[model samples]
Target: MEFYTKPGDYDPINYVPHQASHGTKELWKTFWLLLGITILDFIIYFVMPASGLRNVIFIFFGIVKAYYIVGAFMHLKHEKINLALIILVPTVFIVGLVMGLLYEGNAISLMK
Candidate 1:
């Protein structure tokens, strides 16, 4: 059996597809937005005293950052709705489960 039938056959081992350059505008925007969010998080961390509200604020910011990172950098925003939902629905449920667990644990600790 011959591995390659012809002289100029396709080589699976040495395949590098050509990719066009997409503009960096969207990337720069994502960078700036992430930076602003980080700065805001830092300011809020120092300005607010340690409390439930402060923690909630931090969580909110974290979720926002995660959403932006996934949507922009991961290219999920441009994906079809079904594909995005497939990746995101379980994530939402998992986050909800974690928050619920935290709330229940805090309540149980208070009762102890």
Candidate 2:
């Protein structure tokens, strides 16, 4: 609200900032990214193969999607390399555990 100068005049010094830009570009970008991931997921789900190629392709796409989400969308690009690696420490351990389990699984089947 503006202040009255002399009960008959109003002060014009008071003003409000301009409203933010009007656009939906960012929203559309996010929507498209999500739609793309959804389509990839559907494709991965219905297609089945007995060879290890399927697993390799699945893992490749999974890593790509993860990198995009974490590196670009998460705004982690400005972070230091050490910081990023610190966050990835858990992934390293998880991958190691998965490898160990796969080895054990194969060994057990062989023993049987």
Task: Write model 1 residue lDDT over 1-112, tens digit each, in one string.
Answer: 2355676886877755454456889889989999998999999989999998998998898889898899889878877899999999887788789889989999999999
Residue-by-residue lDDT tens digits, candidate 2, 22-93: 366654675577678768867876776545887787787777777767765664554678988889877889
What TM-score would you give candidate 2 relative to the actual structure?
0.58
TM-scores, one per candidate: 0.73, 0.58
Clash statistics: count for each candidate: 0, 0
**Best-fitting candidate, measured by TM-score?**
1
How far residue 78's Cα lies from its native spot in candidate 2, in Å, is 2.2
Error of 2 at 42 (Å): 2.3
Worst 10 residues of 2 by lDDT: 13-22
- Collision count of model 2: 0
